[model samples]
Target: MSKRLLARVAALTTGAALAAGAVVAVASPALAAPLGTVNLSQTSGLVTDSPMFASAVTSAPCPTGFGEESALRIGPAETGPFTNLTPSLGGGGYDKAPVTANPNRSFQLALGSAPANGRWWVVVECFSLLEGRHPDRFVTEIVVAGNQWRVPVVEATTTSLAVSPASPVEAGTPVTLTATVAPSGAAGTVEFLRGTNSLGTAAVSGGTATLTTSTIPAGSWSLTARFTPADPGSFGASTSAAASLVVNGPAGGVSKVETITADVDPGAFTLDVAQPPAVELLGGQVGGTATGALKQATITDLRGTNAGWDVTGQLTDFTGAGNIPAGNLTWTPSAAKASGSGAVSAGTPANLGDTRTLCSSAAGSSAGTFTCDAGLSLSIPDSVPPGAYTATLTLTLV
Candidate 1:
């Protein structure tokens, strides 16, 4: 997350790389190179009157926003008597026009009324909404002998890689490498490499693959990503151009006089509970209750662990001249200080006769200081003999 400009550069570079590996940057001036040859999808000889199928390959997509339509037609001569294969023949047209989008387009036609012993041309015509009709382009030739044959061609693919932290980084710094494959949806795995050695292979997802590593030594590295397609007949293999990285050695060029002399303790989960001020019944009553503010209690977690803790409190029977039951004390706990605004929480109200949680934190959440306080209530049964009773409230953290 350095400069936004650098992120954009990486993205744009990836797009250009996948268009033609690294060659796209300096390739032919023709920004639009959509015309490619037409061929059958199979090597088997075309059957007479039966459906004959083929796919045309295009080097690039159609001119943008033109609604350009590509029609596949067949004929005996390259010049005349061609029929568009639109249900009038064997009834088929491109799956997705190789001319309009990708290289995996198909068309079918029948040789029902023609003499079976001659050559036929599988032609592609490009007609746009406003641009009208373009020229016919063909690559592979076909022959016939009671069965017409068309050549089958596979689509070619390109791969591009991007690396980050574009600037020189310290040795052992984690670096991210991403590979983008074009025509957008080629299925394969990308192998990330440094020089000739591979760092690892990552499965392509959404036409892109990624790998992260932090084990590089100090030096300059030429990194690349090689794309190995799952179906070679449908798409071809490709490798991205090498991107460069420079890693500096460990910190140096400074002298140390001497090491300091201080012993360091790992850490501790320390808890401090303050004694509460005296609680007094404002008026004499039978089976009555008194409420007071509980003192603040602090808990700090420095153990560097993924554990949680709870602080509970219980009370001893009140005793002065006479005794009162500890069960008469109840508290509503609150966190005066929440370490992460979430890690620690106040506990529910409970009488102190039995230990009850006052404050607590979940595992992996107890990493900072937290302070807790509560409202205290003292309820005495009418039968209890009381005279200035006192009790101890024990708080424990674990």
Candidate 2:
């Protein structure tokens, strides 16, 4: 990004330099022979290759901030008829002068309409460097034609977009969605939609688009406006991608936290602990009164809508009073509050029933009713020994 100055000039063969503050005067014969036909030739400036979106050096900055750089010059081509000249700036064919800041320093020309994303060049005055002569003011001869090239866009581009937990989703749970756009301009907006209902819109700088739903009502939805052009006529048209999202269930409604179970080996029994259940630990006597243990649970996926779902669970040590109970002691209920941070396809937590639990048991008997000192609490059970246990909990998300 250099500084620039543009000066417009015309030839006045016999014009004399002006005095300190007086205007210069041109000498002309009152009745000189009729002038010859004034012919104009088509000419172009110099061309250079540069990266896409890269700025071109127009005029060099002045050393002491003294001299100025003028705008592009109009001239005839080498072998064409001479014609009138018109000044254009910024490559838009707009009749405007080149802007400048420092008098004799460098300046830049903005490269526009360059399709690709790479190198370009700037047209500058032609000057000669020789010994002893400063060229007075670095006088340059302007060449016509050859002044435009392409530069890099310095941005990202995407071919399409995708939504998690595909359409027809349940309400309440969060549904995470993402979009892809190509040639992501400097900056723009990506809009989300539910059949034109504008779920919401997000700002994308590079080439990514993200949107989250607040447990939308069960129905179909779509994503749009993945990409936009920097300026109209930019590349001639606009581009975008699309995706679908469906939501199910009621709006703003709450139901009892569902329970989970597991299907495993007959002897090894699989305890389903998807989401935490109302009764984390359940145990009854196969003979002598059976007792419960430290109980706690963290509920989730009440209705199957959490796009990103996860939970944590833990149970305390179990103690046997004596010996008398039979029927191969079994822990009826499992802990369902244990889970790690995780992600689901695409669907709101409110609309998905995704949860887990943990459970442990030991055979014993011979004593008063089995009593668990530490009752059900959110905290991990302390009576449970340190050991890892995995269980499966089945839940309904309707």
**Pick by TM-score: which candidate is best?**
1
Task: Find the 10 residues in a row with the least total lDDT in model 2.
Answer: 12-21
- Each prediction's TM-score versus the true structure: 0.35, 0.26
Checking candidate 1 for backbone clashes, the offending pairs are none
Q: Per-residue alpha-carbon lDDT of model 1 for 64-166, expressed as tens digits?
A: 3222456556667554455565321112233233442222212233334644555556565555342234322433445555544544346899999999878
Question: What are the clash counts of all predictions, listed in order?
Answer: 0, 118
The C-alpha lDDT values of all candidates are 0.59, 0.30
lDDT of 2 by residue, 327-364 (tens): 11222122222232322221110101122122122122
Regions of model 2 farther than 4 Å from truth: 1-159, 184-186, 231-241, 251-398
When summed lDDT is taken over every stretch of 10 residues in candidate 1, the lowest stretch is 11-20
TM-score of 1: 0.35
TM-score of 2: 0.26
Alpha-carbon RMSD of each model:
30.1, 36.6
Q: How much lDDT does candidate 1 score?
A: 0.59
